[model samples]
Target: MGEIWMIGATGRAGRNISAELQADRHRIVLVGRNGQRLAEAAAAIAALGGPPPRTLVTDDPLAQIATGRPDVVVNTVGPFGATTVPTAHACVAAGSHYVDLANEFQPVQSLLGLDPAARTAGSTLVTGAGFGTLATEALVSELCAGRPSPIRVRVAAMPVVDGLGPAVLASVVDAAATGGLVYRDGRLTRSRLGAHLQHTPLPDGTMRATVAVPTGELEAALNASGAGDVIATSSEVPTGRIARVALPIVGAVLRVEAVRRTVIRLIDRWQLTPPATPGEVSWAYASTEWEGGETRQAWLQAGEGYAFTSRVAAMVATRLADGDARPGAFTPGALFGADLARSAGATITLDSNAKDLR
Candidate 1:
């Protein structure tokens, strides 16, 4: 249905996005710094279904792509803490929609300024398309579906058990080292990771997820949602048959980057993780307390968070190609509404756990 230029298509998360989109018969154009990696991604995705998209490797991507053209450019480039401006500029110049898997908060401060330029250029720009806050944002939204006086949002996510690449490992450490973005008294503030804590429950049982500063994704999502008394947080959750016993230790480890760093080095050095698999699961729930009546709640458990992000990204690309989505820089939540976000392939849960809270 669409041609999406997939940058960093070989990364594990990027591959997952491509895998799901491939099932839908969407054509993925693999773009990366390396021709070899891009070719490998192209072949793999092509095998899934649909014709392989035009693969291009260029230092000057905009100059190179001015001719063949694409519907949208899905950037898989890491840390976008560094290279978003040029890519955003190129996408507008190429007349293509732009999306990235960036999670850094500093970059968004600058990118948000692109709203006017993007509107004038007629291009849609979205970043933080990764796993950071999309699911959490949706959870918070479905939690407060009805008009509620005040809503409380909390989230915890960690990849402690998964097979993480060096880059992924590096990103996690960097994000942690910088402490977290904290929202206080309606102002964006800062907090050290593991500074605050709460024991949150999972399908299995209860675990501790510390409160930290929300990333750009969470910040944008909450601001756009415009909920009353809303606070969102993301932290690591430890799981295992005997893992519950280790929550305190895990929580302690996450608090200090030096401690976490040693552990990550050991993980990398030892090959402790499983196969770098494409499937990743993200589960989130939210609660809403209104002025009267009863409180409402909703929870979501998903098996395909990575791919769904890609599928939604493809939808973004295709629409940008057709000139449907609004032009300008935005977070996924800034786009707003479950109906519109569905285009990004996020499923909703009707069995809200609003009642029965003691």
Candidate 2:
């Protein structure tokens, strides 16, 4: 069995991925900042009738990865903007595979930019191994397969997460601070934070409101469809008229270093109510248009967002550890194909005909 080191093992996503890895017979090493929490998480893993996980309490996860090179390292920490690049670099230097559930645009693009380095180091790096990026990315891939590059592409993520964690909140804040982005004429361009508002039609005959956000799904869709223009929207963010008016101002304010830090601190200390699950299904929609007016649209349907993310992260880490993936950097669907989504308990529906492809 390959040795898998899970950073932030005390966190929700970390614990779930650790359990999945252990259940698959991989040796797990739980790494976190809190010794007690790490020990507790290890005990929980041991209770699952698998080999008890080893624990490492460290403030510098990069140093640990460099010193004790595990076969694979799964990072559940965020804002991934701060953590992803450095940690992935450490794993590459140590000749270890790296996987993270990062869905932020900057981090995901930064990590994928490491493709050459990872290949040279014989390491595999997977980012956005989660719902937002993977679900939409898989749909884009399916729509574009065996077809020419699309002229335009639009993707929407509507995840029904069960709860909110501090890390997630921090990531959201960081993404907001990064401002809005879209691919225009094959170039990354800045836009208003809540621009390109769309009412995406779901498979269940429901319409969900989404607004453009600078998410990794934007990068994923661009890469998958080779579209000259791409916009990634999400239902998670407020898209009302007032929200649209204020988003640009809020984003500008958060861009200040001190202000962002202060906001993150407040989020950490505040007692956030457990986010109620919005619905039973999470949907990701993608529409691709060709130059000749031919168009294709598809939807990826899955269960709770967190559960799918945990499974996708676990599956990616395990496959990397088992040497089942090639040496390079990629998002999950980019590396493993759309079938990865299906294996992680998602189904794809194509166009008005609503043909379900497993």
Candidate 3:
């Protein structure tokens, strides 16, 4: 059991992470912008078992975190693109391991650049511990587990659930609007978003989403700590048609500096979407294919994406606490076996269209 200073403890992923960590006998220090809300999270964590770590509410919680010097710091306070650098530095300075659930690629890359500094400080700094990179990366890596050459890897992730926060949505738009980054013909290249749409079979029938570019983290993992030429794509489809209609508009707001910053400020002002409602449930379906002469593929279903990510992150943190993890910037796919992703409870299946090997 380790002590965790959870920075966004009252948020959706934070609450879920707190639950997962508590189940493992780790202590949780719930920190949020609200004292009442943090206290509530603390109470719920306490009920889960071994006395909860202290709950502290402060805008600059790192000062408080430095004082406690907990074993781990889970920064569920995203957007990672905005907060990872500072939080990672603080964790290193405090001699605590750092984990986050950010969906953006830029910030994750930033964290990777800090590897040497973190090691010098004797702390492990991990990014993409959550859905944006880890789960999807893990799913894709597992699809081609033991294969070698002449392999073609393709991924299509479609998100269907409550809307992503503007920052997250922007990350998708930024990658999409920028163009597609595909590992085609054994090399990485760029194309446009919405240009790679495919009709995939879903329980409700054929569902559609564009095969967008791969995240830097995903590219690194699929390439095996940056080795193979694996093509990857990620996309978002509205859970409801209304959200679909609003996506372009939201994407627009993100493109403009004033609107983008305003939206971020709004997130900070509200402290959360839906004004203190932490009930965030997200879902996604990922279909992947790996082919040498024959093809093997799988459809991965995560009923509630963020909820599952929180669990994955907690599990990673657990491994780190016990010195069971490698120190550096990483994704679960880069570390775990196929069973690692499966044991966490995602629905996995062999692609039906897979042709006969013989």
Candidate 1 worst ten-residue window by lDDT = 152-161
lDDT of each: 0.58, 0.91, 0.62
Candidate 3 Cα errors over 4 Å, as ranges: 65-67, 149-151, 159-190, 201-208, 213-217, 225-231, 238-253, 268-294, 351-358
Q: What is the TM-score of each candidate against the true structure?
A: 0.74, 0.96, 0.78
Model 1, span 1-358: residue lDDT tens? 4467776677776676677666766666666677888788878878877777557786666665566567777776654654576777777877777887666566565567777888898878887664555666666566655554343444443322245545555445445445545555456665544444544455445543634443564465455445444444444422333444444444455558577667666755764533343435555545455554456555555554555555556555555545568878887656645454555544556444535232
* Top model number, lDDT: 2
lDDT by residue (tens digit), candidate 2, 226-254: 99999999999898999999999999999
Model 1, residue 33: distance off in Å is: 2.5
- Model 1 residue 332 CA deviation (Å) reads 2.3
Q: Which candidate leads the pack in TM-score?
A: 2
lDDT of prediction 3: 0.62
Over the full model, what C-alpha lDDT does candidate 1 score relative to the true structure? 0.58
Candidates 1 and 2: which is better by TM-score?
Answer: 2
Better of 1 and 2 by lDDT: 2
Ranked by lDDT, the better of candidates 2 and 3 is 2
